[model samples]
Target: MGEKSEIRMTNDKKRIVIIGGGFAGVQCAGTLSRGLARDQAEVVLFNDENHLVFSPLLAEVVGSSLSPLDVVVPLRQLLPDVLCRTETVRTIDLAASEIEYESDDGEIQRLGYHHLVIACGSVTNLNVVPGMADHAFPLKTVGDAVALRSHIMAQMERAEVCPHPERRRWLLTFIVVGGGFSGAEAAGEINDLVRSSARYFKNFHREDVRVTLIHSREQILPEISPDLRDFAGKKMEKAGVSLVLNARVASATPEGVGLQGGQFIHGGTIVCTVGSAPSPVVGRLAAPTEKGRLLTEPDMRLRDSKNVWAIGDCALIVNAHDGQPSPTTGQFAERQGTQCAQNIIRVLQGQATRPFSFSKLGELCSIGGHSAVADLFGFHLSGFFAWFVWRGVYLFKLPSWAHRFQVGFDWAWLLLFPRDLAHVRARPTDRVSHAHYQPGDFIIRQNDPPLNFYVIEQGEVEVVRSSPRDQNGEVIAVLGPGSFFGEKALLSNEPRVASVRARTPVEVLVMGKNVFTQISSTLTPLRDALAQALNRRRVDVWKDEPQAYELLKRTPLKELMEPVPQPLLKPTAALAEVGHAFVEHGNEFFYVSSDGQTLDGVVTITDLLRARAAGAAAQTPTNQFMTANPVALAADDDCAVASNVIRECRLKALPVVERKDTRKLVGCIRVRRLLAYVFKHAVIGAPDSCQARNQLAGGAGRGMDWNNPAS
Candidate 1:
């Protein structure tokens, strides 16, 4: 409505606007165009894509039996009399009888309609499982099918060149979650394609390729009879497909799927066809919804709205024939579309609308290798003959003869030749992404090439390094949310120094090497923070030494800290008073407080010099030059923690308090004194001094200057 163009009605004729181009929307538009005169109404259809994807054949696309375009029909060609629009519908205003859509150039446009049909089907949603959205392949769209096909070919290519047998086995494995029609068909096709194609590759063996289908139910194909379901399952297993029944998926990760009872299935490729949610536009409507689907009356009209109609997968419509909610399938949607059109015509003709009724035809599912199962009318069929019937029915179901002919030719060609193995080699682009890991999963291995920098978002990970004393790696640090890792190896352009494994189920924001380097180098604050963390982690080597670890743990801050050198001053004390006190006590800094007991602020010699350089008078309040709420340590903290804090904050010394809550001034720990203590007791003077002293003194000398005051 804001600066948007309004589509004016031609000759003041009625306009019918449909919001999707799926089976329902297309059939409704076609019926309306044929039933109404040109002068009576104008039919306008809106869809995000120009073509309608035949979802039933998507698995064949992934198996490379059909070209990606073979299963799609152009909407404009299918509905010549209807005005087809590819603009994305943004909002529906039922009160105004208008809908807003974004044009190709990103300009908003509005069109008023006498009638509105809601038919936008549901969308694929993988968020039901923890990591499924990030790691699994969805089979809901044409693009999804093509992307999965390319990934399958890429994995096979990688396996051919892999030197290790275990790694190659992982690469050749594929897992499909959900035992529905899509999942079962995909698993069957994947097994057939990989096994049949293995004969051509010199390094591949049929036995090494594994295709697993995981279903949570006792048997698959619940839409058909139990006999057909059993036949389909047995046929798939006989064709070399592993079926895991009665198992529920707890989460999905880069490694594989994790089951509810702590079973982890490891595979290289994972396909998910389980979850779905209503379209965003439909979900936003102000109407009663059941399980995210818009509720509609028996006549296919939206509840309490005469001019608005709802149909397809986005709507929950009760079928008069079955006395139950209609299933979300192509057959049901097409029938609903036809009946809804008749109801709309009846309303215009001043006649009462009829309730929608339809008897379901049948259910058919292909199990690859020229075998399928079918339940049609009262008859059930399976095996090669059933596969032929399934193909015959869907071939004629194509929108036009041209499409049917093309698909039929492709099917004939597939019978004579092997499936296509050629794929476009697209270079992967570096970007930031998210990843999930289950407990005990290795996120990164020691000595592996660093490819991603990780920032923890949830759960915890352990940084593990190999040790001479134990075969299992030692956990040097446990990192939780807000912590980051992998930057050390990336910044140094070397292999990982330590392996990172998930201590609990974890999620992390991962940035590729190039993206991480570019952002960190350009952002000064981020760069400085990473450098500080690197310096703090560099001292972890001392923790692995038994004597050094014991010494650090035994010594407390109260024992290592020196007494406060100068008397504390009030907050309102003059700068001249602070300078005189510093010179008298021969200290570089002094604390300032209102009562001299509670720690408030600190003023250093650097603060006084800067104030003087700025032409500040000696009468200026010291509070103006003091740092408020400075970093302080508790008296009970150990020397190891103190050393790490000093190195991280890059401070000469830090104030120590008796207790954090009391804020009573106790003493201060100096960097020089801590370093001397560590060298004398833990490294150079210790009984196990040779290795510890050489490693620390030699490797740490390049960055540390012992005599420098600020070190």
Candidate 2:
């Protein structure tokens, strides 16, 4: 935005710029035009498409029961007194109170505002599930409805020609990845559309079509009560819609949807209404936000900036009545928008503005086959009656009379005729398939038949191979994004040599061995990249092998005999005897034991001082002053485990005993000697950090952190 010269207010009229034409922006603009005079303020509303989409009935458009034009209201006509601009936002400068936009004529223009209202609700977030942004159908706008409706028709047509039952089943399957209002209603409407239209095609049997709703939660329609959700679920099931509860999408592929528990839902079409992420502009702004929504004061003004106000889904406004963040819904947003206009006028007139406060009046959702669920006036209603109420409420809420008449006409016409079966061109899926794996999941197993070569798109993987000494898996190396693996097996025509496990939740592009081989045979760059990666991995595997002396690394402490004094004695010994015995035996500590082998406790200097300060009798036994069950290392455990215990406890030495037979005392290993052994053996083939010669060879020694687990 340009500074002073471009922002000079014409006629000294303050400009109120609204950035969205959605429910909140439209209502706010309408109320502003009526409350503030033309000379008092210039109201400008901006939308990329210059239309207010009636989002509630968007599913009807996809079902072909309503026309696309009926669901959107042109901003210019809806808010006649306000100036409407069809422009896409490029940048918003909150500090300067200016906005940069690309006009329809492809010109860069700047505008300054006195009060800025951000009502740009949200866009469909398909990024949560891998490949969904490219593969899954979204229903955020009228265009989405058109594309989806067309895709549904195309699938129907394609199924009619398909001879294979499995291919036809794939074509006929439609899965919605959410069980909320949008997803449930979309699935329900789709079921009606396909089944109702199936009778028209001789080859399109009603049984050929299938619609499934997948939700992560135990029940659907979280906004509604459990009873209502059950009511809705039962209705949907009876209407021939399948509900897959407690299943969340792990990823999406052209073939189907994969769930978190390794369950795959085969389908040709996948629709996602599950997640919504914040806009990039919201991230660019410097302000407080809750879950990506801008935090707003009770009066609807942005918390940090005085001149800025926000409403709708993008703004997390607190409801003064319940003191909770308001739910993102059409009715609530409209109320917020109306309250914002009043607040703006009050602020302009130098009066105290009121906080936004509204209790939800009602809720309504259509669940297909002329059935619906509604909670109005604190009373729940369902079946045909709720369906009728759903239609009436949305019809009355339509912004313009033109939309009202057109939508009412479509519904009236839909009752008498089957939805139009016009074939729509379906979008082509991406050639590369993507999937996500959770941490510890084996992306490829050792000795498993090679199926795919994976290119890491996100997160890291640990290349794990069996150690020669123990045959237990040891992590060899960590590979990150842009690294490709599985080429060795493809090149050698063998099963996988090493397993790849996710070090974190990972996203990867999977190419079949055939396609990978073909690419490697032709593309020099890809071939060179694979060759370099394979060579590094091959060397990594060789280095990963444990040396023969690595046996010492794994050998239990019980097997390493240390000729120390036999310190175990009766716990009932006198305090004088304990002190004299410790001096005579040349030991810093003494173990209290009832039997010759079982260690009951330890009497260190710290324990003795505390006991003496507490004024224990001079005749007290050593057991009375001892610290019991101090963290001890198991005798049968490896040296690595013993070293870790010694390091963590910050102890010079620790008692070791048989884990299976705790009565048997093996020996105690000193920290200094443990370090000497580790340095002598661990550094031979391990990473360079283990070069511990200086520390162990009589130099001043410090405690080893051993914090790096992989090392």
Every candidate's lDDT? 0.83, 0.77
Candidate with the greatest TM-score versus the true structure: 1
Clashes of each: 0, 0
Residue-level lDDT tens digits of model 2 in 500-535 = 887656778988777787888999999876765443
Model 2 bad stretches (over 4 Å): 1-7, 104-107, 426-711
Reference-based lDDT, residue 613, model 2? 88
Q: Over the stretch 1-711, how does candidate 1's per-residue lDDT look in tens digits?
A: 244647777645789999999999988999999999989999999999998889999999999989989999999999999999987788888888889887777777888889999999999999999989988999999989999999999899988988768878988999999899899889988998899899988777999999999999999877789999999999999998999999988888877899999888888899998999989898778899999899998998999997999999999999999899999899999999999999998998889998889999899999988999999997999999999999999999999999899999999998999889997866556899888887777888777788889998876576666645544764444555677889888988888877888866788999999999999999998898798676656544443454554565568889889986568888888988888888788878888778877777788898899999999899999888887656567687676556544543456788887853445788898876766676676343344544443333323422221111110
Q: What is the lDDT of candidate 1?
A: 0.83
Reference-based TM-score of each model: 0.76, 0.62
Backbone clash total for model 2 is 0
